[model samples]
Target chain A: MNIALKEIVKNKVRFSILGSIILLVSLLTFIISGLANGLSQDNASLIKDLPSGQLYMNKEAEGTYNLSRIDPDIQEKINSQQKEAVAFSIQMGFLNDESGKQRSVAFVTSTESKLFQKVKPGEIVLDRSLEEEGIKVGDTLTHDQFSGKLVVKSFVDQKKFSHAPVAYISMENYKEIYRTEDMQLVFVPTAESSLLFKDLQSFSNRDFLKTIPSYSAEQTSLNMIIWFLVVISGMLFGIFFYMMNVQKIGLFGILKAIGLKTSDLFKMMWTQMLFITLSALALSITFSQLFTSLAPKDIPFILTIETTLQLAAVFLIIGFIGATLSGIQMKRVEPLQAIQQGEV
Target chain B: MLTMDNVRKTYVVGDVKEEILKGISMSLHEGEITALVGPSGSGKSTLLTIAAGLQRASDGHVLFEGENMTTMRPEQVRNIRASKFGFVFQFAHLVPFLTVEEQLILMLDVSASKMKKNETKQEINKVLQLVGIEHRKDAYPSSLSGGEKQRVAIARAIIHKPKVLFADEPTASLDSKKSNEVMSLIRDLTKTLKMTTLIVTHDEDMLRYADHIIKMSDGKIL
Candidate 1:
């Protein structure tokens, strides 16, 4: 109840020093958190907002239409039993714009999707970054490294994969470009099935993407980095606080002899650390916002609240644990020794 | 009333046990100023610490109001220390950054009293005025002279109106003139408040102000 917030305020130098350190830590924590968040969002930003709860794809196709062998019979079979099905097809290929560079994403083609309606046949609908790269609407792009030519149509939202941007196209046009005979690919609801879909592999979007080896493998690599940074930082904070406590033995001994209880002293120290973490988090987030503003959207950056909270929580918990360990050292300080030795 | 009955303190260095206080004992009555004077390493401060419940005695007991102080739990000891005992030390230990008035306020902040904030302020101002540093209430410790800082330290100790005020070399760092003046202030404060005060010091000159004198040598009261 007697938390001395005023005492902290009064000692502006110590308070500010502590707060500044905490703020720096918070900022670093936030940056790492934001980057992790941005990576995840960039990975599935557009797909996460899909209106349908699940995506349906051919079984043999590895969860994506690009790999799926679709038959209209199976698409028709699934549609008859329940809600209407949206037959969509998507593939990955290079579009050599006027700048003559190959860029990639699994270009989705859906007659049933608003995303696809933006692109016209033989025309490219690429990310706006392509515009800055000297590829404009009137420019021509070579598919699959000069395999063919297509006109640049317009810019849509930039969804990235391994640093490549995705462009949406119509199903018929998609087929026309790829020249593939399998035009039976489609999306259906989770529950609907019919005999016509008999001999067909159906999958929702989440599972459909998981079927892609690259999605799972890419996530694994990125996740390792994020987890490492969080864990290492947490440990680093814990150790730093612990050492600070250890270095103040004489001071603590003096305080203890003068009747400052271990509990009270530790609470004060923890509050100091909390102050540090909070300021750092705010600063880091602010800096990250600055970073986000300067960079293009196609950089695959996505920052979210959940990421910040998760990282900050990590720092706080680590710092507290460090405090607990340091507090235990206070028990070793004998007032008699301090007084007799004149240490404090 | 407070009494130290044959208390002792010892420390173990690696594998060796070193004895510090050797069966020290005493009694402090109300309105008395006692100085524990001794050479360096004589354990005067250690004895005082044991008597104040800040340090546990290796052997014997400290009794306050007929209760065994050395036997009480640490929380109980801390509770009493806050409400019944006060402290002053050589360094002025004023928390470095607080103004004089703010420093005095910290003494009462730890106590669980629902006494209104204004009452707390009144008591703090009263202590400052009594210490004759009311004019410097807004000043920080670093800005004050040695004498003035000790005056503030005295004010801090008595602001809580503790039953016992323990000072460890209260004037050790001050010049003789400042030391005497500070000692006089402590004597006056004790008389005014009718509280028991025990000061440990190596400065022999401080003895003239003490109502009771206890000479300590090698942890023994001589």
Candidate 2:
């Protein structure tokens, strides 16, 4: 006889209230987490999409990627030493279409490398988002700083920088627009980049992402909210079970008096917790995944299966801790008290 | 059979160590309803709980079938309490969520009974009928009348065929008519099952059902 299950089945309304709260909390966490990930992708997908490697910048620039100017000689030496090394520069700029409609774009140029979209001097490759704005192949775009007009050659998928679609242009056009020959960063696709350079500081992929001004602070606040929700859910689990346990104190005492093991009472509470958490998590994950797919393209929301699974595991563990803490009173119940307290 | 040899229970509040059961000794025989009757604060309920293994005595031994339950580990005592003893409290104390039938099934599970599934079901039905509650087997405690709930509590207590039945003010929550019905049911079941029974009650009318009535005052039997 599974009394735990029977109790849940018998008092559907009571248990559903707890389950709904868990579902709502978990759903909120998932949606917020998705937004956080989406915002991250929007902020730096151009750099993040690249494989893990070391990014070298001028040591004197002090963690600001734009201010970092790699010396051409050192860049040449490292490029020769590491064949996979790629030097790149990104500057937020705008482009005017044939109709003179201006659109924000990140002007990006990299040395000959397979890691980036390659474009000829007269042509431009753009992020697919520009295509949504009606820009297409053969459309000529003009920039205020550059003397020449750039014809759109093609569009690539999901390449963004500093929340702007990347416009992959040739080194010649990039130099003409920016009027500087020095690239801002050099990326080497190797784990061991501990080799000393004269004026460059080496950073891992994650450390380099932090060089972007608003990225860490934005992620920090969003992550704080996500964790706060998780903590609140955990506390809610504890408090809900605490309230239920308080109501059942007399019943637990009577059960104790009747020779029910204290562990059995704990088991019952845990069984109920596991059932509620799993069911609630399953529903929330499904809804969040649906929301991920159904959300408008403009909304920055990305929920991955790995993240959802990890959060689900956390919710279960936190709920277990909460419910178990509340059940401490079960072990403390005196059957004599229940015997005297009048009917449960 | 159950025996309490010089059992004492002391509870401390602040600095004072108050003795609830002071060196009490008693024995309950099989097929007899042994009533512990006394005034409030006279420790009849304390004695009953100690003998029932609901609480541990501060000193001395509680022997059930020659085993000293007082000295046994808590888990060991709990095992005996689950298997060998049945309890009916002042309130019906039926788990409000469980139906009458589930209540007995829960009891059988708590007792760790090895009866086959069909046999357990048969035994639950048999006990429910004995308590005149077979008709209410599917009813939750909330829907049952006071008498009916008490009957279900009794059925749950005895469904596993315990060696001893402990009733503490089992009729306290019911009116005269219902109290009489519950007391009569307990008496008949104790006799039929040949189990030793211990009861604690202040009500004078309930004493007639007990085969051996012990009056206590100041923690000692009179």
Candidate 3:
């Protein structure tokens, strides 16, 4: 008979109110989630793009990547022991174009490896974002700290660090500008956790991301908002169903009196929950994906199918828990009591 | 046929044990209306509920046919209530969302009837027509008048062709004219279907339609 669906169709305004609330909440959640991912990519795509591995830095640096300096001897030893290992260093710096306009960049230099772009001492590769600002291949750029001029060899896509375009320079140029004889870190791709060295701490790829101060703080706050929305939506289902079940206690009792199974009542409530949640998720996913494609280039909004589906699954499970909890009252209702309570 | 052999029901509140039906015993014959008439708190309604399997008897046996219902499990009792019994309360108690036709269909589903699609529709129509509300089969409970809602409730109750029909003050909420109409309908259905019927009511005017009238006072038949 599908009494649940019939009730929803008959009382359109009532169910629509619940549906609209879920739609708005899930839509807001999707938008915020997209912004959070976008900001995360903007803040540290350079390290985030790296394959799963171990990162070793000086133990005395106290979890600060910039403060960590791996000795040249230790770097060479690890490099020899781990064939895929690479010693790398990054520092915030500025470059002046031929027109004398200064632009901030993260100057990164790494040992000869396939993991990073290999640039000659007199050449450089830059993130594509710099191309939008009129910098092109073969353009000569100058650094104030060094006397030599370097030509832009090419441009790479989406390589960024600390919200700035990454400029890949050679180890010789990096040492000349910073006057540092040692690399800041050693990265070994696909390395096991058991691999350790004296006077150094190893961090997994995910844990290494936490070493960046702005990355952790930003991600933590935004992730907290996402979880809060998820929980609020669950409670919304609880309170909303609680109220609806309360009003229909008499109806439930009457149905039970007529020999409807208790499990049947639970099924009815579950069917309604799934219907409402799936509908809202479909709309929110469509709108969020549309926003992803049409949003301004500077908005930094990125929503993927994987994240959307994961959140939708969470909403369904939470809503089911909420509705089931509220339905506990239905099991306790006595048909005799309801029958005595006058008409439903 | 249904029989009660010294059935008892007691309610305990805090430290006090109050007995509602004290050693009640009765029997309902096939194709006859048995009315339980009593004043308020006289336990007539309690007896009806116990006999209908809506509640448990504190002591003694409720035998339907040859099986003692009191010794059966709750699931078994519920199955009997779903398939072998029908109920009509004082109020219509129709599901507000379902139309008159859907109400009957829901009852058919609950009873687990094996009627096919066409047979189910024909049965629903037949019952609605018998209840004199065939034209209002598409109407929701909210739009139906009090009498029409009761008629639909009656149709829902009998759609499954239960063996025993239970009515608890079925016409107490209706006017005198409407009450007589409902009583006459119940009497006609009981004889026409050859089913055992038990009714609990305080309205003496409705007694003329019953074949057996048991007047109860202080939980005992007088």
Candidate 4:
């Protein structure tokens, strides 16, 4: 709008340096943000998509899905209040492939679930990530050193979670896979059968995640990693830009002496920094997503627009703060020096 | 025209109370070229800065066409300078980021919001031609020579077509030939525009251009 602004915008070297820095910060923040989001989803993707209004798991178990087994008596109380009850079998352990390679996986007892109800006997839904390790339909998955086997029935859209994949299977199929009859729960797919079981066992779906020992801890750790990235991105960006401004004392004084107001000059600096940050972040984020799509399956990087927006907002905020603190030296410019210092 | 009435300025250096200018009085006429001449410690630049409203006088009034500028707010003073005054410092402090054309336009871009782009551009071209740098319009300050920079500074000073042009040692950085060229251009431009001009210099060679020369020694006007 003014000479100071026009000059800054037109000055390629200064703007390029600033813009590139903002872009790097934005990209880093966005990637970390994406990973943070991806991490949380990985922790709960299987549970979050379950169709049941409530899931019943053992309150006595260490975790929601791992150690929790519904006390067979609570099923009766849950059935009296609901039209249907589906017994769910949740298991977490390693499953070996035909090639003798093992991968960590979660087993969902095939009960008619609201969210993921399509289950057939001898069939397993593979997590999206494990698809790379020779996982496909008709492949046999051996559980616990070949104690049992189940044919991979279908590979659904469930995401690649942190380090494991989820498989949904019928109780009979899960029983054969796990080599145990301890998972005696039935999915209340039919309305009438649910009432019969509810009189004997307690159940719920929403509180299922709370029953897992590692669920909350896993989520918190992933979020902590994400939060760490958020912080460092802005801090590094602000420091670099602040230092750049600190080096321009002579330029600022000349502008002030020639009657450029300090506030306007500051606004110009902030606007310049913001423009740079926003553009760079956008460019980096767009390219990163393309890279992610072309990357190998095991690398779990998921970028979303929501994550990018959050990252850009942070970059802009940090840029403004840095430019503001950096421009504090603007007030210290002795305008008189511009004139009093001899022309030599 | 610019006038300072019995103006006084003081400086504080710890316990020392040093008076820079002690009751200096002078009146400069419209369209007349005036020189403020003094030794190093005689407060010539101090008086000039106060008259330009860049600094405040400890006492007395500065008048521009009978307008009491002494009590004017900084904003008011800034407006006065933007609309009524042009300044040429000893050093041509052209914004390094801008070209010679942009440097001249910066003065006319008084408000950071709205700019007089067309008029300022027209004026820049006119002044460049007047100062004889029309050929070097696109050149940056870093690319310009010493005399060329002073010529650009003079071009910037008259770009706004202010009521008065203030030059503090405008020729101090230039050789004799360049100084004559810059001074003649200033005088010719001032006469053509009929704007009052003032210069503060220790250069006695420049004394010829001044219609009225105020001599200063020890903060006293002679």
Best by lDDT: 3
List per-prediction Cα lDDT, in the order shown. 0.70, 0.91, 0.92, 0.71
Taking the tens digit of each residue's C-alpha lDDT, what string does model 1 give over A49-163? 4555445556665445556666766665655664556666556566655555666666766545443445666666776656666667767766652344677778766554434
The lDDT of model 2 is 0.91
Displacement of the residue A331 alpha carbon in candidate 3, Å = 1.1
- The local lDDT score (0 to 100) that residue A199 gets in candidate 3 is 97
lDDT of 2 at A320: 95
RMSD of 1: 5.3
Per-residue lDDT of candidate 1, residues B103-138 (tens digit): 777667654445678898888878888888999989
- The DockQ-based CAPRI class assigned to model 2 is high
Q: Estimate each model's TM-score.
A: 0.76, 0.97, 0.99, 0.83
The prediction achieving the highest DockQ against the true structure is 3
For candidate 3, the docking band is: high
Q: RMSD to the native, candidate 2?
A: 1.4
Question: Where does the lowest 10-residue lDDT sum fall in candidate 3 chain B?
Answer: B148-157
Among all candidates shown, the one with the greatest TM-score: 3
| Best-first order by lDDT | 3, 2, 4, 1
